[model samples]
Every structure is written in C-alpha cells, then in structure tokens.
Target: MSRRWLSAVVGSLLALLLVPIAQAADTNLGDLSLSSSNWAEDSGNFPGIWDLTQGDMTISFTYDGNGLVDASGAHAWAELGVRSLHSGGFNFNPNSRYTYNTTTFDLRAEGSSTDVGDVTVSSDETNIYVKFVVNSGSNCTIARTRVQAGSSVSGFPRTWWGDAVPSRFNHQTIHSPQVIEYVYTISRSEVGDGDVYVAANAQIYCDTQRNPRSRIVRTCIDAWAGGVPFSRIGDTRYAIYDSSATRVDGSGVWFASDYDWTAGTFGPDPAGSPSLDIDDKFTISRFGGHAEGDYNLPQTPPDPWNNTHFWFDRDDVDQWQAAMWGMAPGVSYNTNGIYHVVITLHATSATAGTAYMTVNGASQGFYSNGWKDAEPEIYPAGMTFTGDMQQLQVFYGLLGYGATHSVTFSDITIGQ
Candidate 1:
C-alpha cells in the first residue's frame, strides 16, 4: 500500500461520528464503558455517543464473538479472530487479535479513525482521556494506544508486553511493516479517568483489513500502522512494532482500552446467556485470565453447556469429558472450544505458572486454544487443576457439567 493510500485508511479510521448520549463526559468513566456482555446485542447502535472517561462503552467494531475468542477461535465473521500473542506469538494472522493496551484489550474502534479527526483528552495521576475518530480509508495501518513495551515504558506495569511509547512505536501505527508494531507508552503520563480527549474526524483514510489487501487499492498504503511482528516475552525489542502488543483489527475507532480478560469482555454484545449461568460462562473463562481486579460477573439465565476437554490417551471413556450441553439453539459452537476464561487466585499458594487444568488426574490441558466447538471436544475425567480450587473461579463458560447444578457446592475439592 502507498503512503497516500494509508492516508485513506487512517483518515477513514479517524472519522468521528458523534453519538447522541443523554449524558455527557461529566460522569465517571469507570461507569461509562459499555457492558461487554451487550457489546453485540445492540447491533452496534450505541444508545448514545460513547462516554469513555465516564466508564466503559459498548464498542462497535462488531465482532461476531468479540475479542473474547482467541486468535485461533471463531470470529464475528465465522472463524478464529486472532491467537493469543503470549502463546501463539504474533504471526499477523489477520483473523487473530484486535488491538493492544497494557491493561487489557481495548475494543472501542466503535467510532471511526478517518482523516484528521477531533480528540478530547483528560489526565490526572495515572491514566489519560483520549477521544478521537478512527477511519482507515487509504492508510493501510489501523489503530492507536496499546502497551507495547516489552517491559514497561517507565515501570507502568503493562497489561501486555510491548511498550506504548518511544515515538517510533506510536508512529508505526501510521507507518510500519506488517510484522512489527510499536506499542510502547509515555512514561509517567497521568491521564484523568473523568475528562476526555477529543480527536474527532482528524486521521487519514485507508482500507480497514486485519490482513493484507485482497485487491490493489491504490489509496491504501501499508505502512508501520500495519503492525509489527509478535515478540517473545524475553526479547529486548525496540524501534520495531510488536505485533504481540498490537490489536490487529483495522476498523476506524476513536477511543479504546484493555480487553479486561478477567471479565472476558469483548464488547457490548449480550451472550445468548449470562454469567449467572456458570456453565454458559465457560466461554468467558476460556478467553481471559485474572485481570487482578474484582469485577462482578453479570447475572443471567443458566444453560446446560460444557466444553470438550478429555484425555485422548484414555482408552476407557468411562465418565471423563468436558462437553457443552447441546440443548440450546442460536448459540455458536466449535469442535475445540470457544471463549477464553480468566480466574483469580482467591485462595492458594499456587505459583503464577500453575494456571491450567487436567483430565482424569493425568493429561493436562492448556488455555491458549481460546474456545472452540470444532473437532467435537470430549472433556477428560477427574478434572484437576494446577492450584487450590475456590468459588472465586471465573471462566467464559463452565467446561464442566450443565446439569441442574447449584452455585452452592455440597463439599470441597482440590488437586494439583
């Protein structure tokens, strides 16, 4: 893609279409971000203009399944969106990841990031407010603001690797190779969570494609904004775009934040079910890890759904299996599994490395697969975990039983 072409993508990505909100940016942003659960239920029609600093928002990039699905999992378009950079590494597999921000995966490309837009920002001691239009018309690159520093730009415990600053990374989003993305951030840059930074209708226009151009679009310039290569956790990287930290979706969006793996929140799309249905939440737990926060799970109806997790080596299929109850209609599925879940160590001496589960007290299972319904999963038996079990466990959906189980357990169990 040519530079001028990138201008179009960038320009289109920056198009800020102000939504009419009954409320303004004066409210607490902590309460403004849209409910990740309902991100898709509204069909991208935000009730009002987004109020980022006020709280969370209902993103509009419109993922059929939201980033909650892993890179190799199903997508809003009926395939794996993106793989987990931490495990899959950044292969630039267009269908994988979305964007990058240290704290979490930001899903607010809800607006456009097209040519020169308007942005309103607020700052304080730690975070800053950034509201801009995103429209990638001609600029082959897409997106902004993600913690890309392999370490921390200035010791600001990043949610992901990849830095968020050093100008080069910041600019790469506008002019970099397809395999690299600079995601470092400014050191000690305090941003207010209340006020908002407005950058509306101010970016260049470019075609929005997570992958390369299918056709020759002269106006689209594939540049640094194309994202960089995925970095290994131990690499001392610089001057290169860290695909691992880069969210790869090219929809013109204005404001974005972390993906909140703990909540497994992809956007504002309500699940066919809700968190109240622990088994139904299997997808959520499968999509993310402990965000290290106290996020309440939303309440919803229960569904007898369990994902596949069985030991292939086991000759006797006695009672070992992890399959979702296939009774509900209209819900998506895969042979492998779907949804990434996150769990916090509410009680345990388990090391950070102890974050997986096993079958029949033998073969172990990994969480990097995201969630899928492909291959027809058969969950293993005698499911054991790497750490002590507790009620604090969180996941996208219960990979266990979908029977009429109660939140109140009859006894306690633990395994290693």
Candidate 2:
C-alpha cells in the first residue's frame, strides 16, 4: 500500500475509537479572549488569536500556525506568541495543547501567564505618588518597571515628563505576585492647576531571551498645590524708553544718574545725564565721583546729597528695613520670605575704571565685558539685615580722574 493511503487508514481507525472533536469557539477568561474557529486535524496552516485588554491597556497575540504532535500520539500543541514590542508592551506564549483521554480529547492553556495588575495614583499637597503591581506568575520574573507624568494621557513620551524611563525600578529580581510602588515628586513650579496625568509599565523575562513588557497603563490625579505668587515690580526688557533715564511706568524705581559724593562737591545729576541707550538698556557714561544708577523702592526719599553717602535716612529706618527684606515697591512684601532678584548686564572701562553691583549691602564685582548672568540673589527663610543698605545699586567710576568708564544694564528683574 502507498504511504499516504496507509497513514489515512491509521487516522480513520483512531478516529473511530476516539470521541468526535468539537468546533473551537471563542473563550473569555477575565480580560483575556481566546478566539478561534473550526478545529481540524493538523493542516500546517491553522491560525488562532489571543487578545488581552485591561484598563487602558491592550495586547495582541499572533499564532505562528506551526503545530507539533507527540511522537507517541499522546498529545498535540500550538503556541500563541507575540512579536517584539517596545517598553510597556506585552509578551507571552500561551500554549494550547490537546491531550488524549481513553475516549475524548481536552484543550487547555499552559506555560507562562505573566501580566500587569492594578495601577493606582494618589497625591498630597507637596507630592504625587504612583503604584504598580506586577503578577509575574510562577515561571517568569519582572525585569524592570517605569513611571512617567504629563499634562495629558494619549501623547506618550512626547508629553510625558522624566524622559524615556523616568522612574525606573530595575537591577533586582521581582518574583511572582509582588507589588512595586513608585513615587515621583513634580515640584509645584513644574505643574499647573487641574489634573495631572501619569503612566506606569513593567517588563517580564520568561527565560534567557524572551523578555516582554506590559501595556502602558495611564491615569490622572487632580493634585496641584498653587505655586508662590510673584509680583514683578521691575524689568528693563519691557515698557522702558530708549533714551529716558526713568522707567515709562512712572514708578521712579529705575534711574540712571549720579549720586552725591561729598557735601556740595558733586550732587545728583539730571535724570537724562546717564540715560538709556537706543537698545533700551540703562547706560551710565563717564561721570564724576559716585556716579551710580539705582532701582529704588517706592516712596524713597530724594538723595540727601550729603557727604555721608547714605541713600535713605537713618531716622526713618522702616524704609531701609523694607528694601533690605525683599520688599518690592507696590506689592505686599513678605518679611524674610522667598524672593528673587536677577540681573544680567555687561560693563567696559578705560584705564582703571570699575563697575560693581550692591544688593542689600553685599557687593559683587563684575570683571568681564561679555554678558554675565549674576546668580539670582535669593532671600530665603531666616535672613537678618543690618547696617546701611544699598538696594540694587550699580556704580561705575574711574580711578584716575580723567579716564573714561561706561556701564550698561539690562534684564533687571525684581519679584516677591
């Protein structure tokens, strides 16, 4: 007899003794779906699908249609597999096998069943927290976990904060059924009011080469503590006239003029003497002793033009006290509270000329002519002010009487 004919006769005899095979129907277990149709003998072309959908997460499985039968005719099997995917993607091989009984055949699921569990989010006044539970199953272990935060949900790493794997739980083996809690604190300055979105993921390794990730699960929390309110009282970048010494806002907070060096020897010059340049920068040209430009607080008294070189009166100490304590002119200044004063400028001098800035009586000299960003002078908690204070003063002068000196200031800002 022919080999094909003999094989067919053997298959017919076995079929007569075995129970009838039933048609494959779609099966649903929790969030997983095993979908297929029409069971038949090994045809070398059968394809099945296994789909898993959880909260905001979906995974697709592809069957390779390569079935293997036992040499002793005891069982037959096929595998539902996954293609290589990125982080926060899923991987698994759900083996569908049929074992022969005395008169019937049974199909069942076997092998690794790794998956991601519940992902929860919470927040307080100062921080936002996230937790991820990974069910690694008995055969596999978790390799890594990652978390990210953003303004919205759908855009992924584009809108997500902390970069591509921001908060990583790595370098350790997490066995079956363990929960990994990840907490990331986004400062109040980085987040705004309303909902804040977050996403979490976990990767599992079944063996040496098979490593698949769970689908990215995303959620949001309505946790946004309001940020510190800052009232800007001065900025040279806007609303300042090109050639005028005083600010256009009429606050009298910015002036480029000379201050009195000695009694009746040199007095405060006109507001236009060391006026603003065409670039809207405060410029102080060559001038006599104690030529200075200043950003003064509101209600400051006129220069006494005395030989003592004091800007504010010693008797009315409250004005001096407020300026030293980060009190901008119009805003309600916080005493010893957080405040920022930033300045950016450059200076040039001929012969022995010099340019320096004095803030709250502390002096920092500028050495280079290139644009420099003076470190933001911040007055944080627990600061005490003493002695005579020069609040944001820029002084330019020459050592030898006749040499020339020039100073330009820009981007001066005061906030509280």
Candidate 3:
C-alpha cells in the first residue's frame, strides 16, 4: 500500500473514534397543521369546514377582550380573537382524538368572538388522550379548546344520558380550561360524531391562581398502544396519581423525612427507618429533617428537594405555610420498615416534561420524559430501585416569597 493512502486511512480511524456518543432524548412539541376549508356562516356561529386549516398539535394563544390570537404560529402575535372552528362529523374518544392525518383546519378568530366556543370535530379513534399546549401572550386570557366526541346512553364515568360516548376531564370545579392531558375512552360499539371547544390561553387553559406553583398544571392519559387492553392508569405504569393508600407515613401534608429520595435496590441513603411506601400510587410525603421528627430536616442533605422541611406532591407550592397551617407539632413517623420516596414532577409546560424527588430537605434530580428507548420510559418497575433516584425537585420561586402558586408533584413511587 502507498504511504500517503495508509496515512489518510489512519487519520480517518482516529476521527471516527473521537466522535461523541449521543444518548436518547426527546423534543417536547407536536406538529399539527390547520385545515383549508375555512368557512363560517355570515352569523359566524354555524360554519362549514370542508378543507382548509392550519395549526400545531400544541397551540400558544393570547386572548384579550376582543378575541384570541395565535402566540406561537404563523398567526403568532396576530389577533383573531373572534375566530373559531367548524365541521360536520366527529369522533368519540373520551380522553382525546385527532383529525385524520389528511384532514386539517384553521382557527378563524374573526367576528362574534365569545369567550366560550367549540370546534368542528368527529371521532377518528377510541380512548383518545388529548392535551393542548397552552401559552399566554397578553396579560389576559380567552383562548379555549373543546372537542365534540359522541354521546353515551348507558353511562359509565358519568351519568348515562347523552346519545353518544360522553366525555370526561372537564374542570367541573372551575370553568377556566387547564393545560391538562385529557383521557377520553370511546367504546368502539358506541362510535359516533363529535366536536370540541377550545378557548385561548387565559380562559381556555389551566389558570394559576396568581401562582403557577399552586395550580394543577396537567392531567394524564395512560397509553394502550403497546398491544395491551385499556385499564385504569394505576393498574399499568408507575406514572399513576398520588393517592391516600400510597401514604405510608404522613397523612394529609408532606414533611421532611430521613429516608433517601433516590431509587435503588436498597432505597434512599442508609435506607432510613422512617420511609414512605406506595404499592398503588407514585408520590410520597415522609418525615425527614430530624428523622426523629419535627426539626429543620438535614442541612446540605444528599437529596436536594429535601432542602425545605416539607416534601410533597409537586403541586404543593407552599410548604413553609404548612407551619402556619400546623405542620410541625402534629407530625408523626413510620415505624414499619425503611420506606423510600420518589417524588416526580410532570413539567406541565412541555409535552414530554420532567420532575424529581427530595430527601432530607434537599433537591435530588429529575423525572425524565418517560422515554426509555423511543418508548415511554418506566422508572425501573420492580421491587426496588437500588440504583439512582428517578425523582426530582424544582428550584423555582415556589419555596420562597417570590414564588407563584404552583403544584409541583406529578406522581410518586414509594417502595422499600
């Protein structure tokens, strides 16, 4: 072989060796376009949508008294508050649904802008899980998102009266729409027509009561795409909600604990005597700080989220107030076995977001987007996670005076 050719080959080999390895990661966005069949009756109430439309799966909107505007798309910063959606047919997914891959429509915020409205729709699938990525531009909010799935005459999740598969996930407690993941389970036998109503940011999405931390940011819809029968989310993944049964130590509120917030075969640090455990739910609130109970939790602890004397569902924006509400004196400790807590936060802002856990009042790590390998990841489904903590904690102003009201914990996993 020629010396020049040999030298070039050696150089190429070194370059290839130096290339960095890329681990799996996911981008938090959905790509949806608007339909072209833009047609609204002169009254603007009843319209016709045969073709034209354009928008994204996650839409950011701004709605003033005039109407709603697209804050992030082509119409971004464009006020079309008076616009709306129209259609003929509909689908019946209770959690969510989407237009056919071929179908598309545009949001026409034109005349007759009402704070409340609906979009033309129909069922394309069953048990559909839907979530609208909502963002605010104007200080005010009016953007709303709704869907018309079929009716239900038998009644299951709700009363049986509607003609088609009925819907769930509506905030019966509040009218303000939320940045929530809605799960609609439509029985194939009860298939029919339906549509939805979605307002922009303020009125349409989740409204934080002056504080984002105290707010319920999102809801979840467990998936059955992996050749599995649909069942309650708790029966499937560790991503289920926090329930009472999951509480092994603290009853109503969260408190500092001595257990390790990290996941492992042995469980949090020393695998302390007092721990939080859950065979059903995921979130856990245990006593730490003193391990003996009622002190300021471990200082400069191993877990970061444990920094505050209180630990809880990511939703509990204010833990210090627990003192005002009587947090310190009445606290109790678990005498059973060493319990470990993995507090996860579902970042409502991103589609595939993150959360974390706390140990001895310290911030630990993050709950990564549930993606194991292009698939929704699981936090080591087994008897224990004697490895690392998959839970997390936020440094947002949530713990201090400057923090807005917010709900931090998304889910928790308690185990030995």
Candidate 4:
C-alpha cells in the first residue's frame, strides 16, 4: 500500500471510542480474591461494575438470585465480555484494544446459589487462556457472549457487539442454564505484559426491563520474551568521510559501496568541491549513495531490529527523475525470517513526484505535501531480506541524475 494509506490504517487501528454506562443501582464486584470459591454479588441491584487485577486468577459473580430477577421474577439472562492490552512492538499499539490472549471453559451443574458462573485467566510460556463457565439450573442463561480476540469480537448476534457489548442482554434467549462454557487463546507475543480487561452484564425480563453491567476485571500477564534494546549508532551531527568513503572521524558512520548495483556513487561525493556536506545534519545529492551505521559485530543468530524512525527534509521534488529514500538494518547482521519492514518518516515531500521509500529492495510510491507521518510496510516473496547483512543504514537514490536533487537527514534511530 502507499505510504499515506498505510499511515491512515495505523491511525484507525489505534482509535478507540469511549463507551457510555447507564445509571442504575450498580455494584462493584471489587478485586478478585485468590480463592476461586470466593464469589461476589450485587444483591437487589439491576446493573453493576466490577474491578480486579491479578495473574492466573479467578472471579465469580451472581445477581438477585443467581440470575437477573425483578419483583415479578420474569427475566433471566447473562452476558460476558473480555479484552486485553499490548504495547511497544512492530504492529502493536498501546492504546488499541485486544481480546483475551487465551481462554477455555468448564461447565458444571453446581448446587451452590452463589457459584452460578465464573471467569478464569491463566498463561503459559507462549500463550494466555481465558475460561468462562456458566453452571446449569441457575435460572440465568447466557443470552449473549462477546470475545474480542482479533480485529473484531466474534459471537452470535453481531448487531449487539461493537468495541464493547451492550449494557444488557438483548431479546435473544438461550436454554436456561444448560452449562455454557467458552475459552479463548492468544499468543504472549501479542499481549506483552499488558493487562486484560473483562466486563459482565445481565438483564431480567421484568415488566419495565432492568439491565445491569459490571465494571472491569483486569488480569496481568508476563512480559514478552524478546526484549527490545534501542540504541543510537552515531552522534546527532554528521561525520566526515575520507576519500575511501570511510568515516575519517571517530563517528560510526561509514559508506557502503557493495550495494551500489545501479552503477551509482555508493558513498559520499568525492569531487564536487565537497562531495558531502556536514553541519547539524548531512546531505545526499545526485548519484545514489548509502550511509551505514557501525553496530556491534557478530550478532550471532542475528537479533533483528524491528523498527527505525528518522527525520529528513526534501525541498525540491523536481530535482530528479526517479528518487527514493529508504532505511534498513545495518549491513553487518543477517536478516532472515524478517518478513515485514515498516518505515515511518516525519517529513513532507517538496512536490508530488516519482519519489518512493524502498525497504528490503521493495519500493512504494511516497507522496505527502504536508508534514505528516508516512508509514509503509514492504512484503516480498521468498526471502524478505535480500541484503548481504542486516544493520542500520539510510540511503537515497536518483535514477535520472539531477545535481540539485538532495535530501538532508538527522536523528535516526534503530531498535524494536
């Protein structure tokens, strides 16, 4: 997809609409106790909100009489909703909502009045599972269920489910306490030490209809295994390169000529009265060139860098026929199994032209007249990374030479 479109998708995915809670004689289920048998209740209350924070914990709930019962005792319904959280990764956004990382179910016809239904959350080395169980003969049946595990919540009656469930069960009815159970599973990679939020609601078919919803039951999960270590490879100021395109100073910036496959200048200019200009930032003009960073050598097994963000200035789009600005992991480590590369740069194009952002040898047109975040992901067949090695590098190319076509860059970072 184009960089602009990709950025819009990212923004839309992180947008969350706030839900409104109806006023009622609600109850707070309080924090879930370590004891699974310790059930909470909201006696004579129609709606309620609950709160809990724990890992590998259990919580149970019961209403008027193990079901939503009005003075006339007509309605009997149950509803459950669960969501999780994730942050600091390639595709993960901290504000985005997630479904249960994992879930399972255990249904039984318990004879206890307070033990009508319960929700359990647990995790393993690689996955988290959430279990929901509704005992039989509680007079309350699971009229609806909502599980937001992926892009959308999946269950019967899609009309009643959105970013969150309705405040009460709908007119739909299920067998009275036939022992219902539901389980959901998600990768620990997707949750990364984030909290899981669960909410429940019930409704009684009284003459006027009274619905009650619980607060939230939050659960904690372990941290992600692949820890991300972010570090800047060079100083903020541009480093001067020698005749051989090697950093003459101590700066880690170096030129890479092995990738100059288009018969272009693969390093800092060597003859135009000052092939490369260095002030607070650096400039690249005319023939294509690649400035690479010097990372720690021999990253055995190749710990791949997942993300890199940088700032640049392109003032004249008509300077060249075909121009492209791109970044990649350095050319010292291997990039295997790295299927996707997303580049987000904060800058505006001077004018709409044939400019693109190249990633892993894949290119996508870039066009932005106003300053905005342009994000694009490149996916190619077979080996996604076709370079000699993987490290951090920023390069630009000009297919049809234009002496004035130059771009300035600064503050580049490579990490998770």
Misplaced by over 4 Å in model 3 are 26-187, 191-356, 359-416
Which scores greater on TM-score, model 1 or model 2? 2
Give the whole-model CA lDDT for all candidates, comma-separated: 0.24, 0.25, 0.23, 0.24
Could you tell me every candidate's TM-score relative to the true structure?
A: 0.17, 0.18, 0.19, 0.19
lDDT of 4 at 311: 20
Q: lDDT of model 1 at residue 265?
A: 31
Model 1 residue 246 CA deviation (Å) reads 28
RMSD in order of candidates = 25.5, 37.9, 27.2, 30.1
Model 1 has an lDDT value of 0.24
Model 1 poorest ten-residue lDDT run? 391-400
Q: Output the worst ten-in-a-row residue range by lDDT, candidate 3.
A: 75-84
Better of 2 and 3 by lDDT: 2
> For every model in order, what is the number of clashing pairs?
220, 1, 116, 27
lDDT of 1 by residue, 1-416 (tens): 99999998877766743444465332211111112221222112112222122232221111112223322222221111112222112211212233323221211222222222222332223333233333333243333333222222343322266422224332224323332122323332332222221111111334445557466443432111211222444222222222223333221111111222223332222444222112122211112331111111221112212233221210111121223332122222221222221111121222111122221122212222444444323322111112111111110111112111111111112111
Candidate closest to the true structure, highest lDDT:
2
CA shift of 203, model 4, Å: 13
lDDT per residue (tens digit) for residues 121-225 in model 3: 223334322232222342223233333222432222322332111134232223344333222333434433242222111124323354765854432221111
